[model samples]
Target: MIEHQLIVSILLIVAICLLLMVSHRIKVAYPVMLVLGGIALSFVPGMPRLRIHPDVIFLVFLPPILYEAAAANSWKELWHWRRIIGSFAFIVVFITALVVGYIANTFIPGFSVALGFLIGGIVSPPDAVSAAAIMKFVKVPRRVSAILEGESLFNDASSLIIVKFALIAIGTGQFVWHQAAASFVWMVIGGAGVGVLLSYVIIKLYKWLPMDENIDTMFSIISPYLMYICAETVEASGVLSVVSGGLYFSYRRILIIGFSSRLRAENVWNFLIFLLNGLAFLFIGLDLPEIMAGLKADGVNLWTATAYGLLITGALVIIRMGAAFSAVFVTRFMSKFITVADSRSQGMAGPLVLGWTGMRGVVSLAAALAIPLYIPGTQTPFPERSMMLYITFVVITLTLVFQGLTLPVLLKWVKFPNYDDHLPPEETERIIRIGMAQASLDFLQRNNKCADVKRSALLNSLVTHWNEQLESEGLATLYDDELRKNYHNILNEQRLWLNKLNNENERVDEEIVRHFIHRIDLEEECLLKE
Candidate 1:
């Protein structure tokens, strides 16, 4: 079994890599390709069934993903769209879950409201993994991106909470309205509080402890897990715990982390996220055959299950669209009375895009599979578990494939606004660079930090270089032309010398050459950042 698992893992990685190569040529979203690739590979003979334990995904896969998304976002920007994100994250999730649940209960045979809601909750929140992956290939306004990303980040808590309670209602056959309601409030408050507290303590510890860049980066990775575990231990929402912790730490990263740690952490986190996301989407595809088999064993016809899945998927999309448009309309109507600016009033394109971007991915599958196998008091299996899993799989497939594929076309049709609709990014970045350069020069001069004559002269030279460029073109690139040229010459010289030592003199170890090359690359990167 272990060897089979290893082979499957290796095969999946190779397939993902090949698909990624083709993704750029086809101009399709990478995650979508992974999904298709996974689906395609599953048809191969003797392919092992890849099972993702629900606890593993919820505990292991979720924390870092949530943390990275939360940390990457601008807290201020997220706050600006607080109302819209709130509507989509909390209100839309509840509305969609209830609507889908009620529809499933009414239309589907032998399915109760609890079962309907269980399916509803599983599919409610849009997967950030899918959304982020898709966003890489499309251009949308910053506000639109923020709202979608924010909705994905925060809505998991809302949907997961609903699923948790719905599962309880199903498992125990008891629904305590007041207790459930109170539980929701406590989870939200406690999760956020715990996350914030943990972040504070970690930041202080990071400051007091004498740790290297590697240790600091490791701590950065582990902090999210710690926050998540602490929240779950206290019966709070672990999703929210990860988000809050990620947000706090991300906002304060510049103040607490040194340059080397920040750079290394960024690279490390990026690679990890890519690998995790690829595996997740691939696993979604791999689960298809097993879910189909489950449906068959239960005497459910394939066509019947597919039709049911389609109906639920349709309901999910329609309900989400209605909620999104209604939220925009209501917010616009209320803005008049509140003296607030209506950003969505520009047009319906933004709302339309938001409504259509609801792609479900691994989370729904994990939740569906996580449903208990047997009832607590009886040997009977959980009600509608097979159907639920099948339906969840259908929703994930439909959204990820159909919506994911067409999103780029939709963006082009709508003429999606760029972040720099008002001002281009280069201009903004240049302005920021000028201010930063001026501030650095002022501080160095004021504090007499550059005691050496050459260092002080270099600082003066940089100030003059920036001032000249700003006066001429209102632009100051990261490096002065001469300084950049000099660095390149030095880098070229070092590389050539290393090659000579290795090839001609045979005097240098390969490890030493690689080490020196890495050091030079870092130095060059710093110059580029200047």
Candidate 2:
């Protein structure tokens, strides 16, 4: 068994790496193909079943996966569509819970209305792994990209809140509305509050310790799971705590750690996240047998449950498409009072992307596995457990296979290669100036730090030599004060213009983005040609 597990792990890495190459060559999402392969392999005999406990599940997978997803998102991108994120993370989740629960209650009886809501909650948030993977295949507009990425990054907390409440209602036989509401509030607030405190505390400690690259790397490995476990113990949402802590620490990389330490930490965490992501999808593939067994034992056939899943999937698609497409419609009504928001001018998110792109992966599978074994039990397993699993698997399979495969085709049809939404020129200018300023003061800063005039002179001379070399290479554009002032003024005008343009014709900004995209393409072409 141990050897088999080892071989499987080895095979998974090699298989995924090979698949990664193939996917790039083919220009399609690997997840679709991977699941297809899994489904085929699952039909073979003699595979060992893996046992997974819910608590162990999150600790093993969630933190690293969430960290990787969050770390990949620039803080700039996240803040861009803050409103869209709020809608999905806060409002849409609640609505989905209400609607899905209402539907679940109608179809499946002996299930309490509140219990149905718990099921709704389980299905609410989009899976980060799925979104992160599939987003690469789709050519969404910049603002839309920001919303999808940001919502996926933050919605784990909301999804978990629903799951937590559902588990409490089912396991402990206690369900309190005010308590659950308060629980949600406390999880967010407490997680953020503690995360901020811990980040600074870690920073302060680093000052006293013999901070080194290895130390930071080790700390990175430990911190996310530590925060997660601590929050879980307090009945707070561990996902929020882990994400908050990872973000707080990552954003403070420069201030709290040396350059060498930061790099070491970053590399180690990246490797860890890769492993977690691989294991997550692999398990999703391997766990098909369990779902099958559950179905067979319940005497529910796939054809029957699948019929229901098809309709349910349609419901999911309708809701999500209706939500994504009508985003502007909803935002406009709220825009009257809210006063500010991100808008796609055609009121379209581009590329005829009218339908909900539901790419279900491990999270849905994990949630299904975490399905309660005893529902407030007289020891009777949750009724129709097998049927529910079958339905969920069908949803995951259809989405991963269909949406995952066709998304690229849709992009090609719509010319959906988004280059719209140029990076703020002023922001770029500011960054350039700051970098130039740092280069200019390099030697002087070294002298002040080490207090060695002779060494400092050599360093300063070296810095000057380096700057001159870079200037020759066309890298340093001069750090003059006059240039800075003019650049700042131009930036201010650009911002004003941008605001006016956004206010008037939203679609025009798409042109601005396309311009940048074309420029980027040209630069890339030149580089490759060289």
Candidate 3:
């Protein structure tokens, strides 16, 4: 059995890699491709039905993914769009859940309001992974991306909290509004508090401890899990904990770690997220057969569940569009009374794009799967579990595939308003490069007394380079083939010299030599890219 499981895992990995390659070649979103591939694979005769544990998704896959996403976002941008993000994440999600609940309760026979909310919460939050993957294939404004990213981060917490309360109301056969509301507030505040506290400790540990870059990277890998588990232990929102801690750590990364650690951590996190996200969407496809089978066994009509799914999905999109346009108006109104980054009432393109980008993925599935198999302390099955699962799966598939594919076409169709106030990307990069060059020159000049003749010559060369960078309008383009060739040759020679030194010297550590080689490689890469 174990060997069979191992073979299946290996095959799934191979399949995901192939699907991703195909997605890239064909210009389709990888998540969409992966899901379609997983579905195709599931129908093969004798293929094992894999059931994903909710704990595995929540504990193993979630923390790092959320942390990475949160950390990648610019806190400055998130803050500037806080109002929009807050409305979408909290108000929009709540309203959508209520709408879904109302629809489910009204349409589905014997489906209680609490059960309606259970499914609502399950499907409320749009998956950042899905939206981000789709966005990669389309060109959208930076602000739209920021708002979506920020909304995804917070909405997960809010939606899950709704799930929690709904579950409580179901299990105990009671719904206390005041207690649930108070508990929600505590969970959010407490979760954020836990995250902040853990981040402080982790930051201090990085600063005060004697550790290498590998160890620094390891701490980063562990920090999210620590924050998540700690917060969840207190019955708080683990999502909030990871996000808050991630944001805090991201803001303080330059102070906490060296360049090597940052580079290594970035690469490691990127690969980790890719693998996890790929497997997640693929699993959703794989679970389809089982979900359908459950629905059949429970005597539920497939068409009925699908119709409900479609209805809920349509309602979600409409609600999101309404909320988005309303947010623009609200922002304009609020700007009149208070300071805002941009007060202009932008056109419908931004709101329309934002509205259309709501795609559900792993988080919704995990929440649905997390539902208890039976009512608490009873043999009775949870109300409409199979139906809800089917509906959630339907929503995920339709939104991820339909919206994901259509988004690029929509972007091309909509005429986005251009902002003259903000600097162009190239101009921003140039200004930043100039500032960095000037700072480097100032630092070297201030420390000139510490350099010997050999070091001073190197400093002089660096000084000239920095001056050139400052004067250049853009990145220093490597237009001269001879200079590029000479740079490559020098790098190779340096590597050979380092190898010779390593072979001859017993005092110098091998790791230190490898570090220098890595630095040379980085330099060569930068030069070639220039």
Candidate 4:
């Protein structure tokens, strides 16, 4: 059975990968196709059913997913908009839970108020993969993208902290709002504090050893799961540990680490994330049978579950739209603090759209499964455990399908920027080049090699070549006597025209690309001759 299961797992994974590739070619989200395939395979006669425990699901998947998203985000970019990120990640999540919870209680008749809080907790954080993957089809501002990525990372912490309050309501049959608020403060404080301290201590310890990129990379691969589990075991939010640890690494450890080490870490984390995400969607597919079976055992028939799914899904949708629009209104007040973000031309649209695109998938499903089978201090099972799982699965499927497919169109119609202007690749590249040149010149001067005229000429020419390449690529270029005497003014003017053309409300990628190449090629040919 083990051997057969391994074969099926390998083959199914392979088939899904292939489907993902095809979906990429067709411009649809890969998760959408994978889910459809999983559903189809579930009803197949004589197929071995996949029965995965939810605890195992999170343990196996979440660490890698969060790690990859964190690693891929440009730390520099994220820092520039840290204010906006904090707003959405911490502030917005708290507001969302209250808003979503209120609507769920007021509108979804027969649903427990505690469960409404649970619903709020589940839907509070936006799915990073779902939002970004779908964004490929639309044009959002750069600041918006960074904010989305940052908020998604931290919101997991907020959502899980709130989940504790709801869990207390379910398990202990007692709840206090003031205590819940106090617990949230502790959860955030404890989790972030512990994570930072642990990560800092780990850095100090790890630095004493020789730099073996592979071993360090391996450490990166496992850190999230370890930190999260440890934090959760001690009664702090595990998701908080994951995010805080990730941020700790991003801000301190990753920056100080060497490029080779960073690359090694990134590669390992990427594979880990890919496997985790793949398994997550696959499990989402596999969980259908189990959830359905549980619902049947609990007297919630499939048809009734479907109806509940639609009703709750509809309510959540309306709630998100209202919430997101409200977020836009609040942005005006936020604008007094953040001018770029306040501008309608930047990432405000992202939050507005992302506000409505709150698609609950793994986090909610995992939380549902994490519900204790035997209620603590009770003889009975956790109340309505099977029904909760059923509702979670249905809600996840509806949100992933409905929002995942349609958000791109909505964003495009709203005319978001395909690339964020504030990212300023040109400016960033220029700074890097200046630093490198300063280092190179200092090295030459220290070695007393500047007297070698042929060598100096060649070195200068090579640096010039590199600078011209930078200029051609729309990056920053350092000023030089030769460049100022010959090439700088003309090239700078052309760059100005290109920027003008871009901000002039143009669309279509091919033409802008061709224009860049035309300018670059002209510069490249000149360098070859020089």
RMSD of each: 9.9, 8.2, 9.0, 8.0
Q: Tens digits of per-residue lDDT for model 2 on 1-530? A: 79988996687677667766776788666676566666655666765675556555678888777766665554555555677778877777777777877877787645567666766676666655655566686545666566666777667678668766776777767788898778888988887666566666776778788866787777767777777777777777777777777666655553455545544566677778666666666566666787878778877766777786786666666677767766767766877777645433553534135345556666666676677777765586775666666767777778777777776676566644344555454543343334443443453454353233233343334345444543112122324444333323332333333334333443333334223323323332333233
Candidate 3 local lDDT, 1-530, one digit each (tens)? 89988999999999999999999999888989988998999899998887889999999999999999888776766776788898889988899899899999999887899999888888989888877887787777778888899998899999999999999999999999899988999999999999989999998987788988689889999999999999999999999999999999877774456556766787898899888888999999999888989999999988988999899889888888888888878888888899876789678999899998889989999999999899988898898999999999999999989998998789889988885434564654454445545655554445453243133344345446667884322234445565455435544554555545544543333334555556756666566567
Summed backbone clashes in each candidate are: 0, 2, 0, 2
TM-score of each candidate structure, all chains considered together: 0.87, 0.79, 0.88, 0.80
In candidate 4, clashing pairs total: 2
Better of 1 and 4 by lDDT: 1
Q: Could you tell me the TM-score of candidate 4?
A: 0.80
Q: In model 4, which runs have C-alpha deviations exceeding 4 angstroms?
A: 75-84, 99-110, 137-139, 253-255, 334-352, 417-435, 446-530
Candidate 2 regions with alpha-carbon error over 4 angstroms: 108-112, 137-140, 171-174, 343-346, 350-355, 415-530
How many Å off is the CA of 473 in candidate 2? Answer: 5.2
Ranking by lDDT: 3, 1, 4, 2
lDDT of 1 by residue, 1-530 (tens): 79977886787888878888898889888878888888988888988776778988888888988898887776655766688888889988998899989989999897899988888998998987777667788767777777888888888899899999998898789899999999999999999999999999999998898988899899989988999999999999999999998988876764576657766887999998888888888888888888888888889888888899999999988887887788778887888677443534566787788888999987788888888888657798887788989899889989999999988888879854332322454554354344434544455455454553244444346556645544212223434565445434434444444434334322223334434445645665666566
Better of 1 and 4 by TM-score: 1
What is the C-alpha local distance difference test score of each model?
0.77, 0.62, 0.81, 0.65
Q: What is the Å distance of residue 83 in model 3 from its true position?
A: 0.5
Candidate 3 lDDT (Cα, whole model)?
Answer: 0.81
Superposed Cα deviation of residue 325, candidate 2 (Å): 2.4
Q: Residue 445: error of model 3 in Å?
A: 3.8
Whole-model alpha-carbon lDDT for candidate 4 = 0.65
Instruction: List the pairs of residues colliding in candidate 2.
Output: 420-513, 421-513
